[model samples]
Target: MRFAIISVTKEGQKLASDMELVLRNDPTVIKVDLFHKNVKDTVSNLFNDYDCWVAIMATGIMVRIICPIIKSKLKDPAVLVVAENKKHVISLLSGHMGGGNKFSIKIAGVIGAVPVITTATDLNGKMGIDALANQYWFDVKQPQLIKAVNQLIAENGKVDLHLPSRFRFLENHPLVTRSYCIHIWEKSFIRASLPGKEFENELDLYPKRIVAGLGSKKGVAGEQVFFAIRSALQHLHLPLERLDALATVDLKKDEEGIIDAASKSDLPLEIVTLNEISDFKHVDCTPSKLVQREFGVQGVSEPVSLIRAGESSRLILKKTAYNGVTVAIAVSTN
Candidate 1:
């Protein structure tokens, strides 16, 4: 997550610089840019580039500049406004989904300022559905359900939470143990669980635990590669949303088909060198003689997946060929 800090006054600029240094300690923040002039144009250019915007300017000025470009809570970047003297930190836009409300408090803690969070969910001290989804890297399948779930929480109502048995931390978490929530499984549902009768407010979170390795001919079509990967995942009973990333041999670094497939899935493509693939001793999958002769490695997908994952990684699906593409799936040890 990148943060863009915009300031006009000397005090605000100094505060912005100090905040940038303070936020650099967080591993999640990759970059932070400071914009001292051309506030509107700079924000306009950087709106889509950064994850959040920290404007050390008046709230009215922020509103006039940001309102015209504001799309929605889901699509917009988190916007925060700080006073020149750093007395107040205000979440001006994208409170829940964009993480503005939560980040405002973080900035306030560093600057010894009051965080003004106006969101109803935060006001009621109820966990927002979008915040929960963001915490787990879970893509909201049905975004409309977020409103229903948040509304239920805000109304002092209970909603059932379903998670894998292994996630005992979340099951016993302070946030999850609140009176407005209950834990339930697919197989167990008591009559009193839905005391509010809010059947439409369930939130489902899926874990992205699968890493897919891809290999394909140079000129193969993207659709074919995608079809092959999707088919393999379907055969293995793995949801596409659970795919964490895509791995491929470095030789396919410029391959259009594999790139297209990964782009369509919105997964990061981890390219491995030939030496890494050939020397991978963790995985023992079948090797192809033709591939070995041409690519300097007996196999591409399995070794690449194993390299991306550590030595303890487990191969969930062996290399499966479809048309001119090959894909393999692995579960990371961690």
Candidate 2:
């Protein structure tokens, strides 16, 4: 995680410098930038750039400066306020989704200061939905409902949680029995209501487990490839955000259309070599005559999706041909 440490006073600057040294040594931290000059402007300009902001100043001063620039909890960087005397570190904003609470505790531990986290879920020793999403890398489809779901958990009200089978351990949580109803999530859950139930408190969390495999004609436009992938996902009633990555045969590694589509979606493209595909004899897809003759592989989209999805991966959507492109999707077991 990238961090920006800002301080105004000399004493605070010294403390910020010390904190930066400690944070920089931490493996999880990627970079740390210290700023003692133009405090307000620095904070405003770098607010969205870094993952977290450690302000070595009074909480009131930090609050006043950030008030205007504060955005959604999901988009805003975590803000931590530390006293100039180094007595307390407070989680000022974006406690859960932005990791302010966790970052504050880490900073306090290294600096020997008390960590002040006021989020009700943390205080009550219950896991918030936002925190769970962060932990497992799940995308919250309706971030607006996070507050309502967490409020139910905090107040000991019932919250029905639908999750993938791999995440069944969450059912054993201390608060799960009293405040949550756990159900195995299925694709059908996306389009229909559960039988004999009206779960008004249901919260859906989409795990980042889907990988898309692409096969496009030469000189095809990136827009067409992207549209095919999006349309395939929509047919399954899954949000485009749930797509984790893109995959294609190594033969197309330099394909501009595929590369452009991955870049536009901000997802990594996994290149699977034809040798690897041929050596693996577990593919369940039928061989395409043209693909076999040209590429010496049964298919591009199906095998590539399975290989990239890792062990025990299964196809959710088979090769579906679109205009100048073919799209396939698979669920990763991991």
Candidate 3:
């Protein structure tokens, strides 16, 4: 992840340089830039450019400069404040979703300082939804509700975890104390159940499980394609959040409907040409005579899904027809 280190003093500059050198050698540390002047104005402008910010200055200064530019915790970059003496590294904002807490600890270890994390969930030794999402590569739907769900854990209120039989071991997480219920997987629900004391308050987490292959008609509206995909997933008892990406033949890479649906859902779009998909044709597939005559391929959805899913994948849902669209689903092997 890219990090921006803003130093405001001579001592802070020296420490920032030292930390930059140490982080440069770490494979996980992608890019690190040090800024020494015009911090109040320049730092906020770099908010969207960097993944995290390490400010070698007073916490109050960081707070004042960051508060106005502060956005949703889900989208903001991790903010950490460091003392010039290298004695304390405090997570100032976006402690979980922004990876501030973990970044703080690692930076502290390198600088010989104490990592001070103020998030209640970390301090109390409970896992927040953001932390859980990061661990499993799950998307946190409705991030606004995360605080309400975490508040339940903080108040010692009941927070139950309902896992599918395959994931029942997750019930052992520290936050799941009073409630541990193994559930059947053949249901429409996500199976990632984090319910608060009041049933209305809940945290919605979804795994990046399925790849959706789409074939849409020319100039088709995204709403139609998106609706078809959601309906297919619903019919198969799969949560839409489990959709990791959208796959299609290269011809449809610029298809308005496919591109719009992927963009709206924040999913990566993977496309493959007929040549790349031809290699997978021998790998058990349903043939479409009409599609073969028109597109020079037996199938678009199924083969594209397999290609995007890599070698260790299975075709879970064969091509399903929808108005002006064809859809298929593939899952990676466990």
Candidate 4:
């Protein structure tokens, strides 16, 4: 996650510098920027760039500055306020969806300060739907319905919940199951029919378990690979956003088309070594004569997808050719 630390006073600057050192060492943190000059302009310019903002200033000042720029909770970045004296770290905005409350606790622990999280679900020892979505990396289809679902959970009312088989572990969470009526979904929620009246208050969460593997001819256009990937997903009735990552052989790691396609989708591309593919015992895909002759491997797309998807994974789409590109799809059970 990216973080921006803004401070105005000398003491606040000192605290911000100290926090920056600690956060920079954290493996989960990607980048941290410190801003002590042009505070208002910096905040306004970077409000959407960073994932979270740590302000070593007064709560009222931060609130007034952010009020005009604040958008929906889903799009806004997490805002945290730390007292200059280092007595408390408060979650000021986007407590659940933006991960402010969770980060507040983590920051407080690092600085030996108290974390002030005022979200109702946290106070009552219940997990909010938005928090759950953030924790498990599930995409919430209708974020507007999140409030109603959480409200029912907060009021001790039953909420119908639909989850994929891989996420069944959440059914046993003491806090999550307190008011949840769990049901397992076998297919993509997009392809599922509308729920009945009995499930009027249902909340469906889509886990990002799909991975696409690509193999393209030399000098293939990035648009061709990208379109082929989208067509493969559409053939399986899977939404484009459900894709978690892309995979390819190490031989094609320098392929410009593959790199550009992954960049356009904003997804990580996993490169599988030829040695790993050769030694892998699970090779159910059909052997490719051209791939075997050129790369010394039976296939590229199928094995790459299976390798990247981890254990208990199965192919949803076999190696299919699209012009000069080949594509395959895999769903990870883990």
Instruction: Indicate the residue-level lDDT of 51 in model 2.
Output: 76
**What C-alpha RMSD separates each model from the true structure?**
13.5, 14.2, 14.1, 13.5
lDDT leader: 4
Q: Per-residue lDDT tens digits of candidate 1, residues 61-153? A: 899998789887777899999988879999998887788887898889989999999977778776777776554444465676777777777
Among residues 3 or more apart in sequence or in different chains, the pairs in candidate 1 whose N, CA or C atoms overlap within 3 Å are none
**Best-fitting candidate, measured by TM-score?**
4
**Which pairs of residues clash in candidate 2, taking residues 3 or more apart in a chain or in different chains?**
none
By lDDT: ranked, best first: 4, 2, 3, 1
- Provide the TM-score for each candidate, comma-separated: 0.60, 0.60, 0.59, 0.63
Q: Model 1, stretches more than 4 Å misplaced?
A: 184-203, 209-334
Better of 2 and 4 by lDDT: 4
Runs with alpha carbons beyond 4 Å of true place in candidate 3: 165-169, 172-199, 209-334
Model 4, residue 69: distance off in Å is 0.4
Clashing pairs for predicted structure model 4, backbone only = none
lDDT-wise, the better of 1 and 3 is 3
Cα distance off (Å), candidate 3, residue 287:
40
Q: Which lDDT value does model 4 have at 22?
A: 93
lDDT (CA) per prediction: 0.75, 0.78, 0.76, 0.80
lDDT measured at residue 135 in model 1 versus the true structure, 0 to 100? 44
